[model samples]
Target: MRASKNRSQKSEVRSQNPKTYEIHISGAEGVYEDAEILKIVKEYTNRALNHPKGKPDNIVITLEQIKQIPQKVPMLPVITLKCNSPDKAKEMIFQILSDIGVPARTIKNSFKILTSPRTMRGAAIILKESGVRVEPDRERGVRVSRLGIEKNTEKILVRKLSKMKVSITTVKEALILASKVAAYTDVIAEICISDDPDYTTGYIASKRLGYIRIPNIKSHGQNYGGRVFIVRENTNINRLIKYLEKTPIIISGDIN
Candidate 1:
């Protein structure tokens, strides 16, 4: 019985065809140093191989250090509107989206989501004559879709923040991501409402208008906020999403 079991195990190992996956890992120097991260990876690989799902299939992870040539794209210029009241801010947002060819009905529907407390994950509304539909990526904060949109990894973003000479903050990161989405081929415009109770400001970004910030888009303590990406007609949703989420896009020091 012992000899037969040994033979079976050997046969299984020989017959197994291991699949390989190349995962790129990056991080800021101080926050998650390379050596420390590699250790974490090693630990996780062992945990995954022993996971309770079933008899673990073999998984081998290899890391290669490469000179990351980050694509430095220009940051959009800021165009702050002198609107303080939430109502006025709302009007301005509507007018801007309407001017950019977003249908009146779609704009209305999007605003509904922006104001709703339930839309914590935000949404991507595809513009089509047939009808507008919302796509959600709840698991991942708001990228194009589940495929994952690659905004700056914290490391790359930190480097860009230094180049731009700006204070690093979550709001800044959101704006940068918005700018990249605006530059995409089928994306007509983008609107972002801050969920922070203290922050009543929001912005709309697009290739045509740069980044337009509107203060008091919502009242303080209102607590509801989200993003809306107004995409163009007949867009290859999956492909556009892949570009938005997977491509390693970074913002440059140059503005406008």
Candidate 2:
């Protein structure tokens, strides 16, 4: 994995000011186990701390040590969200709508239980206790619908947002109405995710919506080099806006 380059690509996805970043678990691989590795690190640290001056035994690495590491966050990564299969699309839809600062409620996560009567009853009780409404269905174990979320729309440009935002995670089995919308992490407020200029729905949508900021893939030909689609120059954003307005496309999804 070109970790550096991959980070650049994901940065292009715009997000709302997401203070609560979800915890991500990346697999760890090593010849040593966790205990062994911890021991080695402790020893190395103690030696470095003492250096030329002899250090006391008490001044050693403690168990309560905190480590900070530099890393990258994915651009609106949806696959990482914690939700059941059926409610995944609802999660994405609501997240996208909310991020764009649209005041819309009642569009997320409903569960349809298909377990036996005993199991379903137990599940229903738990959900009800958690303040999630559940109703009995003759055909299904239990039926739950509609998720309500709080969205405060502060009229602002979609782009130029500088913090990690939680976006929708389109799952493999998700199907939105009549359209076969593919599951992807749709960047909050901004939706352009393709490197292909031919595919321009998101760009056009942003223009029409008056949210001028849009994402473009990093390209050397255009001299727009970065990991993701970021307008490095403030003036460059204006330049692109002009270029996109005059640029022509043969179809709705196509762009110059």
Candidate 3:
């Protein structure tokens, strides 16, 4: 009986085809980090293996280090997939890794992450597990989705803006002007104003114009000075132009 069992085990090991290949995933930071990649890999692997009844053979996997790459190429990291049948495993990996960027390839030891490069710090594993949607923040240098902003914007803005002086009058005026501009133009992101000492008045004017206040503006004095306000990229240029022309607040220098 013992001899027969040994033979059966050996035969199974030999007959079982192992799949080996690489899967490119988001890097170990930002939206998709190491933990997220690993979790997704494991899920795919299990699915590929079909949840075998008995102990499964160990499949060797390698993770490529995260790094920045050209904009034409993806910035995510590569995760190598190994199994008895590379082709089968590749298909499974593609099916399982949805929302996350996945590249196609043949039987290989390694793959590359072909998505936007992201910083791995503070990456939320829940997102990976749930496959949450993400939107790019091209202007702010961050990868934030609508859900992410909705969840944290109030808290974040309140804390950051609390220290800075905010005049209700100025804020109301900025909002009114900004609303008109937003309706007239294709601006999606809010207009940003600098808070330099000399530009305080301009900043206030911008606020009164109804533009969203961007945090971390250089400190400005209580009164408006000759500071230049920058209309952030991707904003409604027409609206901004109209506001500039219609608004009476001077950003060039202090009004005498």
RMSD of each: 13.4, 24.4, 25.3
Model 1, 179-201: lDDT tens digits are: 66776778787778875566677
TM-score of 3: 0.20
Better model by TM-score: candidate 1 vs candidate 2:
1
Model 1 C-alpha lDDT versus the unseen true structure:
0.59
Models sorted by lDDT, best on top? 1, 3, 2
**lDDT (C-alpha) at residue 1 in model 2:** 4
Clash list (residue pairs), candidate 1: 148-245, 149-245, 150-245, 150-246
Could you give candidate 2's per-residue lDDT for residues 1-256 as a string of tens digits? 0000111234445655423321111111112234565665655554444332223222323222223221111111122233333234334534554554533421111112211111121112112112232223322212111111111111121121212241221110011100111111121122222212231112212221322212222221221110011111122333333222222211111111
Candidate 3 ranges beyond 4 A from true positions: 1-165, 194-211, 221-256
Model 1 lDDT-worst window of ten: 22-31
Model 2 TM-score on a 0 to 1 scale: 0.16
Using all chains and alpha carbons, the TM-scores for the candidates as numbered come to 0.62, 0.16, 0.20
